[model samples]
Target: MAEIDHIVLGARSLEEGAAFVERHLGIRPRPGGQHLGFGTHNMLLGLGRGVYLEVIAPDPAQPDPPRARPFDLDDPALRQALEAEPRLIAWVARTPVLEAVIARLGHRGGEVVAMTRGDLSWRMAFPPQRQDMDNLIPALIQWQGEGASSRLPDSHARLLQLEGEHPEVDAVRAALAERGLEEALKLRPGPHARLVARLRRADGVEVALASG
Candidate 1:
């Protein structure tokens, strides 16, 4: 099955997004690796297993980053909304069939691209979009090549669940399918339609979904 590799946080700017997470979780995120193709960079936190939390924003310094514009930078309301409500943007999965996934996405009226930061030298694949954001869809990523940093500190916020609203739920599911992500993941929402994630930390036990 396609294992969830990360939970993405999309934002117009890193300065803002980083600050938001820190304020809520009371933990500052460190500067993460870069994505040359998508013109993106992020900060990361290990949630569990290989799964991580990535706060992604467009990087202007990249020379060959994607030609995408980025998120709703022009909309003042969008920025304000994000500053007030920094919810989970999406979730990613790791698959052995990276090429096959890319091909399927390309065929299904979507584009896929991979990027590597020269400074840190790590690679990640993402969903194609005109802007840096992909219509609230999870960007698929596959770790490639060598020198990848699996470093993460345990005993942090445990994500017990991640639930999407009515229309958004359907949209995300379809997007994953269009990008060729079925059969590898059992991500279907049940009658409760809640993403139940069990998180255990020194603080106490917590849950993300209601019925979990």
Candidate 2:
């Protein structure tokens, strides 16, 4: 079965993203190494139970990549949005039966592509069009060794719920069900598409992080 692996928070810079997380969740994320080919880097905060929050931004130290970066980081509109604040852009689902899942879903589930950062490695189903159901449809990932969440500093936060609104809610739900992720998130119909994640902090305060 597929389950939430991590949530993606996009930012204008790593520092900005870290600050945003600290401001809301009261915990500063630890540095996550650079994505060499993707021209990005991140910081991570554990959310307990093999789940974490990922703050990702373009790496100024890396040269321009040959292709677009993941999570639409190179998109002009998304960059403008990030200028305002870090946004909860997307979430990723982990599953051991990645190849089997891909075979069943075909192109609808995107293509499996390998990714690496320092000693970490994994393969993920990258969106075929650089976007996946308004980022509400999570990318499927399969870790090579230990999962990234296990290495993150425990922030004592726990994900309570993940919800999203989309115009094509039924189709999205069908796709998620096909991938064994129907129960990972809750969905409803709306004019515009967006994602929201509810998390409980160490001190027992509940916070909601939303994507616009």
Candidate 3:
């Protein structure tokens, strides 16, 4: 029953990411809730139909816990990634069954990690190391249902179907089918991370924001 809930623009700074979005799409994003445990914060733009887009970066103001950071922000590679270019580093999709999705998701980099990121109670099943960023996919989620995003009004932005240039796109679809995942979320595993969102702006012109 779940589809693509959001796209994430993994940036080094919150303002930089939001500005990139505003310049490209001509819409200002609103401040989303904070994830103190994740060591990150985000600004949000409604993508209509209960979906959204996020501009995320490490929150330097948060207290540094004695233990390791919860989200991927602490990872040096991700840090360097933003330093190089604040672009679409990764995106997450919601799954009804957390454990089941983890099992089926063909992440070549070992098992997924079960970690809590503040108010967001979810797990990030990414590559164990930084080198796998090229092949690393998305974090499947089973959100902590608390009406956090339930009451938000979504600005209707039409999402056109996705197109993939990778050869393994069929395999990816077949794998999802094997796992009982939906076909509505068209994704193709590729070398570079980019968000290909086909949406109509408020002015009724169809455009795709490469920012994710």
Candidate 4:
């Protein structure tokens, strides 16, 4: 069965992202190397165990990517939204049998692509276009060995729960169940799609990062 891996936060810039995290979570994220071909870079904050948060932004250091940037960073709508503040855009699920999971999800699974960041390598199942399900459906990842969280510095924060609301809640529930992800998120029906992650800080305060 697949498990919650990492959550993605979209930002206009890495500096802005780090500041936002520090303001809310009271800890700054550490630099995570750039995705060479994806034309993006990130900072990571450990969420205890093998889960973490990834703040991703366009890499001005690189030329435009051959393809559209991941997490819809190139989408004008998303870019405009990020101009205001970072958002909890999406999450990823890790599993050993990525190909099998992809086959199970069919079109919803997206195309499998191999990618690298520094010496770490992995394969991911990403949507061909913009993030699907309003970025509610977790992207699937298969790391070569240990995942990125292992190498990340502990931030004294731990993810406590993940929740989502969407117009088509039943369909979304069925899709997740097919991928053995039904237990990964607490889902409900809403006027639109949105994700929420609940976390416990070192000071024992519970905070929420919501997609808005």
TM-scores for all candidates? 0.65, 0.97, 0.71, 0.96
Q: Lowest summed lDDT over 10 consecutive residues: which window, candidate 4?
A: 127-136
In terms of lDDT, model 2 sits at 0.90
True lDDT of residue 131, candidate 2: 41
lDDT of 3 by residue, 1-212 (tens): 34565667777878888887777677877776567555677887877765677788877887765445433666787677668666655456566676676565555423655544445565555534442333223455566563224544665555565333234555545534543444554676765443466777777878765533
lDDT of each: 0.53, 0.90, 0.59, 0.89
Q: Per-residue lDDT for 9-72 in model 4, tens only?
A: 9999999999998888989999998999899999999998889999999999999999888877
Could you give me the TM-score of model 1 versus the true structure?
0.65
lDDT of 3: 0.59
Rank by lDDT, highest first. 2, 4, 3, 1
Question: Which whole-number lDDT from 0 to 100 does residue 201 have in model 4?
Answer: 86
lDDT of 2 by residue, 44-155 (tens): 9999979999999999999998888988899899999998999999899999989898888788778788899888999998656634788888889999999898887778
Q: Per model, how many backbone clashes are there?
A: 7, 0, 2, 0
lDDT (C-alpha) at residue 148 in model 2? 96
